[model samples]
Target: MTIDSPSLAPAPPAPPGDTAVHPTPARTPSAAPERLSTRAKLVLFVLCAAQFMIALDFSILNVALPVLGKDLGMGQADLQWAVTAFALPSGGFLLLFGRIADLYGRRKLFLTGLGVFAVASVLAALAWDPASFLAGRALQGLGAAIIVPTGMSLLTTTFPEGPQRERALGISGTLLSLGFTIGMVLGGAMTDTVGWRSTMGLLAVAGALVLLAAPKLLSESRHPQRPRIDVPGAITVTGALLSLIYGLSTAAQQGFGSLDVIVTLVAGVLLLAAFIAVESRSAQPLVSLKMLRRRSVAWGNLGGIATFSMMSTVVFLLTLYLQEVLKLSALQTGLIFGVQGALSAVAGVLAPKVIGRFGARNTLVGALLLQAVFTASLLGLGVASGAWLALVGVSVASVGHLGAIISYGVIATSGLPDDEQGLATGLVTSSQQVGITIGIPLLSALASAHVAVLRDGGDGFAASTLGGIKLGLGVDAAVVAVVAVLVAFGLSRRADGGVAVGGRTGGV
Candidate 1:
């Protein structure tokens, strides 16, 4: 499994999924390699811009949902589809495209994805109906699926492992995390001030500028062997992920007990089974099943699933609590998260120091424990108590979430040589996009079920809705808490066996 470094293309940046916190390992920026040339700086800047563009769209549409619904005469059930449509394709297609990027050229794929995203942005901006908008959104997701993996591949290949790459990755990771907050706030402000279309227009403008500059700034790079596309592996994995995400989201609607949910989930599982079979046999597999045996890769992906799924759930549900329940303006909701986002970025900035002092495992354990506490506090949330409690809890909770992100990224990609970095990053990215794809809808469904129960008992719509939200938050907190314990235990076992993980002391 050892990959000889063959002067692959400079790594672009961690794709959107691995972009949980910082791509930089747990090292100080001052420890980074000396004298980054002007061109190196440009490479970093261009890739970061692409990362921000793709990441921004993930949340940009979140705040615009209300306005989009109003403009297109859509309902709550359908409004969620806009988010899912983008997430499913984006998350599902990543491995397929990541492999493709490596085989053909990362630069080519990156540029193409950017152009596709730009065109998709324009399509979304000009959409006059729900179908058109959804179509555009899906295309954008496809573009992101391609762009993120290629971008990250470019990054790892560009800089050799150690301080220089860590610094570069930190920039990439920070920007990736920044997208969610920025999108929520920016989407809200634009939707409120101009229109939902303006939000789409903004992406179009940004994508256009990057699309033009990428070729000039980036040199082409690819895997040295130019491995053949693992078509069966690609098909099966993409199908499994898309089906799984779709099933998870559908379960939120039909309930886990519903026949469709059961059938769809079974199909997803079967597809994944098929994917494992295919990957095990393929010479050039899309995903190396053996990689999962590595402690850092396996456990790190688990941590990623927890951190991303749980944190994103908080944002999605909290936004509902603020706007749908409290009847706050989009701009107000945006401003709150804007502040939270800035705070989260600051937390990310401090990650190296935090990891240095606490060690990676401790950083994650503490962060996740605190996350559990803050998220649990939301269970006590009710509109009657005012927005302050929810705001403060979620805002502070995000800092802990920020730490988990950094630790997970460090864990997932740590100790890997350059050639395998793509596969490692691809897995991390998949975990993230899948987390985002499923978390909101999963909680949304729980919220709906709670509302249904309360309404059946003759509760008011407002009361039932609030009840549902709190219950969902309760569930979210429990999941994160459990993950915290499991990760700590697993990492502890690994550490006892003398494998450093999640910090300078270990593999991470």
Candidate 2:
């Protein structure tokens, strides 16, 4: 399920005398040949381990949330913050950290992030109150922000583009998808057997283990030349992302009509406008406008964001439907997803071969369509006996979900040169992190709003909840189907025009 880097229209050469501005340079895979040594395998292992840990944190707390809230004396209003606090920094800081990692060093950032995450996990595990727990979660998010981009850049740079890179990414994607599912299962088991705090403690141990292994296996990677930070672009985009994620997260729990949500969302929009303006004028932009315009980067990212957002939302809603509406225990819900995880891993392993035959763009589109079809089938989910449908629909859809995940990464990072690897990986990772953070909230808001309306219309709690969930699932299906068409047409346009991929011009 990786992307075939399709031919792209090359950027016009920068003005001959414009040395200060850094244009999007051509990719240089020759700079680092593909490595198949045992050491290379170790590097991949360590990097994937770091990635798995980050993905696990995203969902590990979810199954344990109820136990955690009661133990920490948190109200329903406060419980969401435990998740939002982590998400805000994790999603918000990714692009900024990606650029910084390029300016500084990916290896350095990787180790530093690991240390920060491990320490934060320990603090969270030992927390005595809500405030202390939240502080730890925020730090964990920051650490994840640092780790994701840097780790991805390291993987892309270390494995030269081609079959080797594709296979490596396939493994990475498998672990990432598996990590989320495993987290839910592990969270439930640990919460029931020991305590919710055990989940945090497990992460702490994982962080420490990966941290110790990383330094020996990872080499420092950064831009060949050190450019000054794009301070204005940095400030505006960071502010914008932080504001936007906060607004959405708040809306998830409180509804979007609140004054607090309105103001924050407006500020986010303004700051985002400022960021665009700043980058347009900067000599060294935080993100190259030219790169953003590339079909592979733009459309690839759109597909990436859409797939992750919709798939994660599907999983989240199913978790609710299974546990709340069906009255299934947490462990029972986890077992269903555990099966989904196994199928996802199989799909991940097969993705590279599928990409080789069908091409990344086609694979991406087909995968999304498949995901849409299966997701839509979940509309058959009923109040009494539809748990089987949830299990089948999600598991089968995940086969496509895993393909989309791997293909989008390849498409996004395939064409960029070595120096911009960090930024490219950042964009890829940002799409993913942002997708994960926002999806649950956005759709949850929709479902909740529907439930409120149904309740006001005199529907019982059970009926109203079911109606809201069905509405959400329907929208999710339509959104994925739309994105599939968009990505298909978008990439087809580029192929017809003859675009550059790996310094060669041809069709995808």
Residue 318 deviation, candidate 2, in Å?
Answer: 0.8
Residue pairs in clash, model 2:
1-351, 1-352, 4-360, 7-499, 7-500, 8-499, 8-500, 9-499
- For residue 168, what is the lDDT in candidate 1? 61
Q: What C-alpha lDDT, on a 0 to 100 scale, does residue 34 get in candidate 1?
A: 30
Relative to the unseen true structure, what is the C-alpha lDDT of residue 500 in candidate 1, on a scale of 0 to 100? 36
Provide TM-scores for the models.
0.88, 0.92
Best-fitting candidate, scored by lDDT: 2
Q: Give residue 478's error in model 2 in angstroms.
A: 0.4
Off by over 4 Å in 2: 1-25, 28-35, 495-508
lDDT tens digits, residue span 82-159, model 1: 877888889889888877876777788889999999999999999988899899999999999988888887876675
Count of clashing pairs, candidate 1? 17
Give the Å error, residue 159, model 2. Answer: 0.7
